[model samples]
Target: MTATSVGALLLCRADPEAVRPPAHLLRERMLLLPAGTGWSVLVPEGKPWRGEPHDGPDAAPAAPAAPGGAEPVDRVMGGWATALAVGATWPVIALWWDGDRSGYTLAAGFRRPVGYVWLADGTPAGEDEAMRTFAARLSLDPVLDVQELEALTRQDPEADADARLRELLAVLTRAGVALPPGLAPGEPADRLRTAAGVHPQVERIEWAGWRDAVQVELDAVESTGLGPWVRGPRARALAAAQVAAGIPLTLWGARRRGAGWLAAGLVLLVQGALGLAYDRFRAEAERGARGGGPVW
Candidate 1:
């Protein structure tokens, strides 16, 4: 019998803080950690089957249950990745594999998600349209990027899923994603954690339950470096503009079920609100200083 394992990595093109998912929002098996510059990776303890029927006699192991209904590992990974991408300003690439297949899905702003699939034996099982879309969204150089992607589809028949992922990574190197050493496809969660722990940039994130998770998120927001700009008139105007722009973008996304755009709109709204509030607080501090009150 062939041994089997399933794994996924969530690649983010922003600061680790931007990529950190709230612990309260995740099922038990998922852990988020920094991968490298402009990148974070989510490692699932196992599959995320969560109360669904298996495909057939050869189905992969069931994932830990969550509130939502169950789905296949690949679908679950795609949805999870899209949710993360939709919540932030940058794109997110979810790379996943089971014993029999491997694939990647890229989710970016307001656009339909794009992805490519490959059989375990390295056979191309994805649409060329997905490749074209992937390249276009990332602003990759057309000729070079397409050539590398096309080469993946034409790899030797004996090439396995691991090789396929490595090839994909090579193409993304130009996009400034350099995954830290020891983080790669096919590693067990335990080993992935151990490897991630030693890396200088990796910050391990575990579920701390709901209340604590909320507090953590709030604290992070407060510490962000918005003080200087928020206090300025021009910056305040920009903030107001963001608020103006966000509302319609958000509503449109909801009306159309556009997860990526919804996320971008929400981020804009939150940042704008924070900017306005920061201005108010800074003005109060300056007033207290002028009045010779406790300058806080």
Candidate 2:
């Protein structure tokens, strides 16, 4: 596959506001925009997989290189999808295509990701069970959606890999995914960014440092009426669990040099740390308001 043909899009089953915080945590420069009624899309501004320089308007100052030369678009995106979905309430689906193959990876909270691949010529290279799992996780219409998805897995001379992805998306339209114009499956990364960039409601996502991210996250939680759940023993236990899971996962990713796993581990660690700190600070503030020692 040629570098120019490599492209990907992240589809989150939530609105832009709900997606903004986690998108920031990915630390990649991206364009965020509404997809449809309840879906949001994130288009990366840099081509980390190809290690190609992006000259897009929202491009990062420097594109990150894959650990050992350029990584395949699907692998890189799968890792990113996992990282994004692990800490989110909704599922994330990453659609990626290199010149030779096109496929998708769907990730939900702590669940094994499921995907199906089609060769550039439209040959199916993945398992059938994956389609069923995909349908189930997305909560698509069990019979109708499952039938449509299953059909894609079978032979079809008319469908190339690109066409296959498009069909896949057609099925998702029933679930509220409406990708913006010019953001088709086979388009290159630059074009996808351009399309998303021009969107009226599009917002740029960048690394804003831990302090800001935590504050934003706290605000999101409170706005969602989850503040009470963010504290207390139950919250503490969940936080500890995340920390415990993160350390080894981080080491394992580092050892293997897998960016996706690495990102997932780091996210877990950050969320854990943020949860613990948020609980403590809130407790202190409440105590101070009750005439205990100053909150400082």
Candidate 3:
């Protein structure tokens, strides 16, 4: 299959660890790596649209129903983007392509996703409404941003997918997304990896085996401000829910050969276990700090 058929990049304004949760939620086997300052890239290993996880209640209407059937790609990207954006302080963008089309979706917070589309030949196929929505969702200056966006849509129809993506990137430069030299759109996963590894600003994210990974996660928690939730009843509840949800998810993914979902379940398990551990650690630390005053 060609690059368009199997390759996609999910860009998020969070670190790779923060990016993993939502990607797992989408059940996609994506390689996570740093993409430049304040950004991470998720490279989907397989076609994400084939067996997308259900989006539950807040899901937008299915993508196949979208104009020109562009929603299939959009939904997966949108779902992942929205998952990362909600309950966080950053936005996520999914740049995707299939054999016949290419487009992008920008999701921020709980607001609706806005996207732009292009035909396989690079003909602009998205509605002006999408650009308007895109600008609004990002809180861009109404006059200046809209003008730049409008100019993008008005680009020469003969431009190819690569050109279109470049134009999109140009528009996003202000948002601090400086993708590395080798992380080009439409490259196969292997080629994408080879390039990303040597790029000065890119770092290949890996399991580093479970023990090291877990320790790294614990260390991460120390630097984050999740102390209240991680030390309270809500953290316990969330950890329990993650375990409960992860088992079935992992089983289901294994049965269906869904690498994405399987990875997602594993993440949930890790997060849940870590939350519990962090809470216990906090309790112990508190007791020690207070001279072991009855162990709370």
Instruction: Using TM-score, give the best candidate's number.
Output: 2
Stretches of model 1 off by over 4 angstroms after superposition: 1-4, 21-24, 27-30, 45-47, 50-70, 207-217, 220-225, 228-296
**The CA-based lDDT of model 1 is what?**
0.71
lDDT by residue (tens digit), candidate 3, 128-184: 888878777666678877888887677586677667877777767776677767676
lDDT of 1 by residue, 189-244 (tens): 45665676676655656566765466456445645786345457866898899999
Residue pairs clashing in model 1 are 47-63, 49-63, 86-263
Give the top-scoring candidate (lDDT).
Answer: 2
TM-score between candidate 3 and the true structure: 0.60
Residues forming the 10-long window of minimal summed lDDT in candidate 1: 49-58
Q: What is the C-alpha RMSD of each candidate to the true structure, in Å?
A: 11.4, 14.1, 15.8
| Colliding pairs, model 3 | 27-260, 27-261, 63-71
CA lDDT, candidate 3, residue 221: 60
Q: What's the number of clashes in each of the models?
A: 3, 1, 3
Tens-digit per-residue lDDT, 45-122, candidate 2: 998886343323332343565576766677789999999999999999999987777899999999999998887789
lDDT per model vs. reference: 0.71, 0.87, 0.68
> Which runs of model 3 end up more than 4 angstroms from their true locations?
1-5, 20-27, 50-72, 197-220, 225-296
